[model samples]
Target: MQMHQTARNDLLLDVRNLETHFFGEDSVTRALGGISFQVKKGETLGVVGESGCGKSVTALSILRLLPKVSARTVGGEVRFHGRDLLDLSDREMRKIRGDQIAMIFQEPMTSLNPVYTVGRQIAEAVQIHTKASRSAAMKKAEEMLRLVRIADPERRVNNYPHEMSGGMRQRAMIAMALACSPELLIADEPTTALDVTIQAQILRLIVDLKERTGTAVMFITHDLGVVAETCQRVIVMYAGRIVEQANVIDLFARPAHPYTQGLMRSVPDRRRGRQRRLPEIPGIVPSLREPIVGCSFAPRCPFAIDICREKRPPFLDVGSSHAAACWRAEEVMGA
Candidate 1:
């Protein structure tokens, strides 16, 4: 995988020092802990991490959709098109959401309304964002469904969500997301609930849509293979913070963070001779209730040193547009 230079001026969204916290029974859980990254126009940025690593939370924060009573965006900035989304009013944010930014969630069954026909759902989005009438919106919805490669979209649009298969439902969700031709799309584990074949189809559809619409995407998932196939760059997160950021090729070839290396090794490879057991990263993720004293990954990092345990590592630039937050990044690369 050869690294290519991304057009720096094409950056569409830049998130800086974002922090989202949840108030629980007795403590506050920091879901997004000072995370930062950028998604360029017409490029896909994949975010990979284990469950509960703030992948979904980060996506929700960008839309300002977190439950206000229990969760709040504590700090940081989410800039889209040189405007800070955090400063926008609720009404303004609502207009931006689904019009400028749309999201395709992991589960289409739950995300889609059970009582409404797929066509009606997509038409609703179109009508809300654009000045299209009922008949016009429905026509646009049908076109979008066909665009997502759904067969007999006109008929399918009339069918309720429960009548469609998991794959078809996912495609319907995608059609709804693209109803307004949004500038940015956030897909959180879009294919997680589907089979392998369906997952591949969904990934291909997203790539095709990006190529055709020049829509920037923030694809959140734990599957590295999917990232390799779909994303231009990768952001590795752990304990709510981004630990490494690099172009897809470089990150896969020479991962900078020890935790990232561990994750790569843990992926089962048939090329390797049969092993007694798959590799596993030791230790559980640290509790986010209390403020972390040092690097959150230090507890599980095999090459962690005294310095790593005593202080948080700054995101160090290793090369052009490649960076990692690890004290022993060089040593990890060597290994």
Candidate 2:
């Protein structure tokens, strides 16, 4: 993959050849197969792929929040602020998890503690990370609620997650995640469940907050439309590895990878006639448990050749900063 020179000095998070796996009694699942990417300061980078394509795993790996019993980071480095996070002690990682790096999970309902008021939960995080007094922490929590544009924050902060509407609860989650002014925020499909209007509002709120705080963001989602709108650069993942990476504009204009092209075609086009059916990718993602010698996406690729099915392709730069993991990328893109 092509490494931009600017990333050498500007990146806030640099993940290099990171690999992760989940072990069971009888089988092992390769959750992340040598994934690499960088998130520059105050920039939003999108990681898009179908479900089970290692998007969430990459996030969890960066934070070292994977399940202790089954999952392990086998190789590579996750460097943040020039320090390799994989070398940090548990106590050390604890300090950075919320203070410098935070994550907003997909579902607020399941993530927020059901028994405690939202205020208490956010306050507790502040106290734990900053050593603030309980009263001071609560005050900060209310300010965070207001920052997220929650109405009547003074009263709403006291409401439990279940007491608030879905959008409000999601806002509260964002409030908690940003309470410490993290330099890097990993948002995993933060707006996937919201209504269209609410989704737009949340996206706007995130973009606004990032601008105000100058915080870099790694936004993970399967939505291409969201990527085009929210991210400056996009990484298209497939079968636990990245197949393409490029600036959003270039990617939309010319997707070099077959998988990336297929994803773009699958997006519903309002410009087309009303009776038209959106194009669909031919096959489901392969199970990670099965060994793949060739390109993992070859089974579904329309232009797959004999070599494509027999040998894995290296991720190579096609032109400029655009990179793709297909042997025939030039032909596919030009066609």
Candidate 3:
């Protein structure tokens, strides 16, 4: 009763059947096909899939950052704190973007302004959202640099984006995103370009900062290892749609969807010891430019049946708090 109502109230971001499309000369790429999910307060929700699976698109669309001319959110509602973001004007969306919700984009090198100093850039975000004075925002920026564990923050704040190392720039991005203490932070492959050691450090820093700020994080990455390490729950997307949703343990233990199982098999298992080659998912991913007739993964799924190619499977609960969009979910899980 009371707890249930409280839980509902805790739903920070609710995306309902979000449909996004990119128009071209003669084709329409269905970038996001009515995908829906929820991000609760202070939880790290991972959205993962191979490239072109709409993970990044989902983040951009939720924040209304997609291009205006070609790309449009054709349908759906992105409700943040019970207010639909889709209905907000551009000015209103801008306010919400850095203040209430911040995002760390894929590439820090390009995402950060080359001409602006790191601290100035961070302070700009703070000033926009907090309306702080120049000196005060600069101070806040230095504090954020320290918060992200950047050494010599006082000196580093004056450094331009190009002057810093890849990982350092990424840390700066995180700092900027957190300067306002946003309620939800969307990170799109923030560690993809860093070295193994740097990647580990960034991941730890994000987890630490997220805990310290009590900010809900929507981590979008193709790395299952990162998801397993940082996220409590994850959504597996395929061809712009969610194929499975489960907690880290359940998903790794018992993958209910064939596509998910394939992805798991593709990951290197050190326990198995040297193999000739890693197992691969057969066939290429479907092109989103055309309408998919049935289950998008049917062509590549080994467990796919005739029905899989004939009809789209509903996203259904397979076990407690675990769901998959597969008709053969039980069989796949058991096997």
User: What number of clashing residue pairs does each candidate have, in the order they appear?
Assistant: 0, 0, 0
Measured on C-alpha atoms, candidate 3 has an lDDT of: 0.94
lDDT of 1: 0.92
For residues 196-288, write the lDDT of model 1, one tens digit per residue: 999999999999999999898999999999999999999999989999999999999999999999999989888765775877899899998
Alpha carbon lDDT of each predicted model: 0.92, 0.93, 0.94
- Report the alpha-carbon TM-score of model 2 versus the true structure: 0.95
Q: Which residue runs does candidate 3 get wrong by more than 4 Å?
A: 1-7
TM-score of each: 0.96, 0.95, 0.97
- Name the candidate, 1 or 3, with the larger lDDT value: 3
Q: Which residue pairs in candidate 1 collide? A: none
Candidate 1 residues lying further than 4 Å off, grouped into runs, are 1-9
**Rank by TM-score, descending?**
3, 1, 2
lDDT digits (tens) for residues 18-103 of candidate 3 = 99999998999999999999999999999999999999999999999998889999999998988899999999999999899999
| Candidate 2 segments exceeding 4 Å error | 1-7
lDDT of 2 by residue, 21-68 (tens): 999999999989998888988899999999899999999999999999
